[model samples]
Target: MRLIISGGGTGGHIYPAVTIAREVARLSGNCEILFVGTKHGLESDIVPKEGFAFATIEVRGLERRLSWQNIRTLCNTAGSVWNSIKIIKRFKPDVVIGTGGYVCGPVLLAASLLKVPTMIQEQNVIPGITNKILARFVDKIAVGYKEAEQYFTRYKPDQLIFTGNPIRPEVMSAGRDEGQRALGLDPNKLTLLVVGGSRGARSINNAMFEVYKHFSGSPHIQILHVTGQNEYNSIVSNIKQAGIDISSGGNIIIEPYLYNMPLALAAADLGIFRAGAVGLAELTARGIPSILIPYPYAAENHQEFNARALERHGAATVIADKELTGSKLIATIESLVENPAILSTMAEKSRESGRPQAAEVIARLALCLIKLQSNNKR
Candidate 1:
């Protein structure tokens, strides 16, 4: 089997595509896979690292407002459609899958026009513009949240499968004792895990600074803050300037980034982070209660919608990015830390929302689609 998978621009899109690729490779032995993504997305670095052949096209997202750059973007995007068609003709994939991003638009459109079997994965409660537009042509639609089903109500039932988002296997394997030892965290004190996605949230990093500054003398709580790769140095330097010693604090551990995120999630008692689909999925998968501050500028304000889904289930609490402050954050952390019983309750609820079999379900659906498409072709 030859498969072409297109998606990227964020970890939310990339990781799910990677997970499906792994599943395809494992189950569809000897299948040749190619990834199509933008030259600029994290996929350029990540796809090849996973040992998959990757090709890039210059695709830019459309601006919502009137601007000169938007006009240029529209032209480039049109050019990208031609570029995608060329790639599709050259690759001649048996199946084309899009995990949902602007990059998916051109590739999936070209594939559908070419009569190639195509699929898409939607990771938000409110589907992004790319996925929403491609739904009419997508042979199979795998959705992360059930709330998405209503949006695609116009589609045939068989085409819209409620397969939850694909998650990393490491998440399913994280263990409490192993995670604690890996982070050198004290087993007794509460460990608050702070993450702001892979790119890091400037607001979140600033909140952490306030956290360390206000609670430096408190030995009861330990913090493991991931400042993102871009913000790490500045955050560290600021700490130094404040005469705060991170290494000697004995209660705080700050990292630029974490490749071993499952371990970090497992070790954490409570989480403070953005509520991107991937982040929320991992938190729920690990049954870690979180204080989610959604990215205000996320497309369609979808991150808040995702966070509220978990919040409604009693799995997490939402603090809008605009309202999130150091004092409010610190108070929230302290309140949770003081009440282990409530934390336990929230943890249980979080676990309830986690569909551990999400990836496996998505993998099975992809296989079924491939088989159905193959049979139809024959």
Candidate 2:
């Protein structure tokens, strides 16, 4: 099988696209894959590293209100579609998939217009404008959140599938003990993993100083805080100024970034995060309950919607970014870690909400789309 997968901008979109491509290649045996994204998007950096043939097109997102920029973007989109069509014709993919991004807008539209089997993955509870517009054109939608169905008002029921979000297989395969050893954690104590996506959040970092002070010498719990690369030096400096040890003997372990994140997820009993769909998927797959502070400036405030879904399902707690403070974070952490019954309940709910097999499900659906489309043409 020959396939083309397109998704871009953020890791949330790019990771799922990568996972699906990998899964499809594994299942199909003799498969060839091409990844289409914008040179400016994160996918350009990521897709090539995954060992797939990568191609780029020019595309930009449209602004919501009437503006000269929106007019220019509409024209650019037309050019992107033409470029996507040329790529599609050259690659001659049997199936085309989009995991979610503005880049997918052009690629999927080109594939559909050419009568190729095509699908898009929507990863947020509140669908982004790009995915919403492409819903009518794409052959199918693999949604990460079931609640997202309400927002995608135009599609036929059969076209929508609740496949959850695709995650790296390593996230599921890593074990707690293995993770503990890898990250140098105490297996006897409850572990709290605090992260603000890959880039780190300034607000979250600022709010964490008191958490460090509060739990400095706790025997029952340990905090593993991934501080993100840019903010690490400042945070460590601040922590040291506050008289906390930055050495290995301390209860709090601070990291700039985690290369072995699957192992970290395996070791974590709880998490503090920024509600990106992919990150939440990995956390839930491991049954780690969390405290989420959604990014206020996200395109549609969709991170809050993502966080609230987990909260409603009893898997997490939501803290607005504006309201986040060191005291509030510490109290929230204490509330869960202090109550084993509540934490255990939340963990169970998180596990129940997880879809570890989502990658396979989406892969199967993509292959089925090809078969169905082929038979239709015959």
Candidate 3:
């Protein structure tokens, strides 16, 4: 089968698109895939590296309120739709799938206009504006959270499915011992993994000072903090000024990012993370109990919605961005690590809630869509 997948902008959208594409390819054994995304989005850089044929459309997001910029963007979107039409015609895909991003808007619209089978995957409890609008046109809507169904008001009930979020195969396959050895972590100590996102979280970075200060040189646990690339320098300088020892062989490992995050997640006993849907999916896939600090300014405050859902599942605890502080963080960490029972219970719940096979399920659903379309054509 020939498939076209579009999703871009941030890692949250891009990663899911990539994972879904990989899953689909794995299942079909003989499939050709094309990825459509904006040149400016991270997909341009990441898609090629992932060994997928990548294409781009020039489109920008609209402002919340009416403005000259929004008008310009809308005009550009029309041209993008035409551009997408050309790409879709040349690719002649059996199915088109969108994972959710502004870049998916034109590609999915063009596919729908062409009457090709189309589906979208919504990854948050609060549906993104792009996905919400595309729901009316797409053939199916695969949601990460069941709570998101109520928000997509325009879609037919039969069109929606809850398949959970797709996680990379590596995330499920990585081993704890291999991860520890690869990252130079000690197997005997409890490993705490802290990450904000690809771009990093300033609040989490700032709040971690106390965590480092408190846990420095502790024999029981080791901290691996991924300070977003932009914030790494300042955070490291601050650590030096604070006289905290993060030396070559110290118990703490501070870095800008981890390309091998599946390994990191495998080695992690606990996690502190921003409440991006993809990040939360990985944490749960690994069954690592976590404290989620939702990004305050996310569209529709969806990060908080995502975090609260996990909290309800007893898989994670929510610490609002505004309420997060070094002292507060230290206390939460202490509370969990000190009480083995609570952490273990959270881990079990987290493991229970994980849909490790979500990618495969969604891939099969897409294949079914393709088959149905072929039947209707016959």
Candidate 4:
């Protein structure tokens, strides 16, 4: 199987594409996978490291407001489409899969125009602008949330599938004891994992300071906080200035970033983080109940919708970014931690909401589509 998987801009989009590509390669022993993304996207850095052939096209997302810059964007998009056409002609992929990002626009459209099979995976309840536009053109639409189907009402039922977000396999396979040992935490204590995506969240970090203070003396609970690299120094300084010694705070472990996230997620009894679709999927897959704070500035405010979906399923709780405060956050954390029965129930519900095999499902679908196309040609 020859495949072109295009998606980028953020981990939310890039990781899913990478996971799907990996699965496709595993299923089809001789699969050739090429990743197309913009030069500036996170994929440019990540894809090559993952050992996939990577290509870049010059493309920029259109600004929402009317501006002169949009004229330049229009010109670039046209050029990108032409570039995509050339790439598609040369690669001759059996299928092109797009996980949501602006980069997907030109590449998938070019594939559709060239009469190649194409599919897109949307990672949020509310679709992004690129995926929404591509929905009419693509052969199949895979969504992370079931509620997302309502947005693509124009597409026939068979065109859409609720496969959930593709999560890293390590997250599913890591055991709680393994995770606890890796992170150097006691297996018997209630462990709380706090993370705010790859780049830390200022609001979440600030709220966590108070939560940290509240649990400073507790011996029954342990906290693992991943303050994004950029925010690490400032957060540490602020803690010191507040007269709190984080290093000596017996049960707390703080780091700028977590390299072993599978371990962190596996070890966590509860999680506090932003509700990007991928993160939510991992939490549910691990059966870890979370307190989600959706990033307010995300495209289409989709993070909030993602959080609400989990909340609706009784798997997690939502605290709007605007209303998140140290007091409120600490209170919510206390409520969940203090009640073991409720926490266990929420964990079970979270596990129920997970789709651990989403990557394999999408990979099989793409390969099946390729097989069908080959038969049609005969």
TM-score of each: 0.93, 0.98, 0.96, 0.98
TM-score of 2: 0.98
Q: Judged by lDDT, which candidate is best?
A: 4
lDDT of 2 by residue, 36-117 (tens): 9989988898889889999999999888799999999998999999999999999999999998889999999999999999
lDDT of each: 0.88, 0.91, 0.92, 0.93
Any runs in candidate 3 off by more than 4 Å, and if so which? Answer: none
Q: Residue by residue across 1-378, what tens digits does model 1's lDDT show?
A: 888999999878998999888887777787889999988899999899989999999988877788999899878887888898999999888889999889999999888988888999999999998999999987999998888899999999889988777788888898888989988988888888999977789999987878997766467788889989999999988888988766666788889999888998988889998988988888888899999999999999999999998999999988999998999998888787788898899999999888777777876776777788779879
Selected candidate, larger lDDT, 1 vs 2: 2
In the order shown, the candidates' Cα RMSDs to the true structure are 2.1, 1.1, 1.5, 1.0
lDDT of 4 at 257: 93
Stretches of candidate 4 exceeding 4 Å from the true structure: none
User: lDDT: which is higher, 2 or 3?
Assistant: 3
Please tell me which model should have the higher lDDT, number 1 or number 4.
4
* Ten-residue region with minimum lDDT total, candidate 1: 213-222
lDDT by residue (102-218, candidate 4, tens digit) is: 999999999999999999999999999999999999999999999999999999999999998999999989888989998999887899999997889999999988888888868
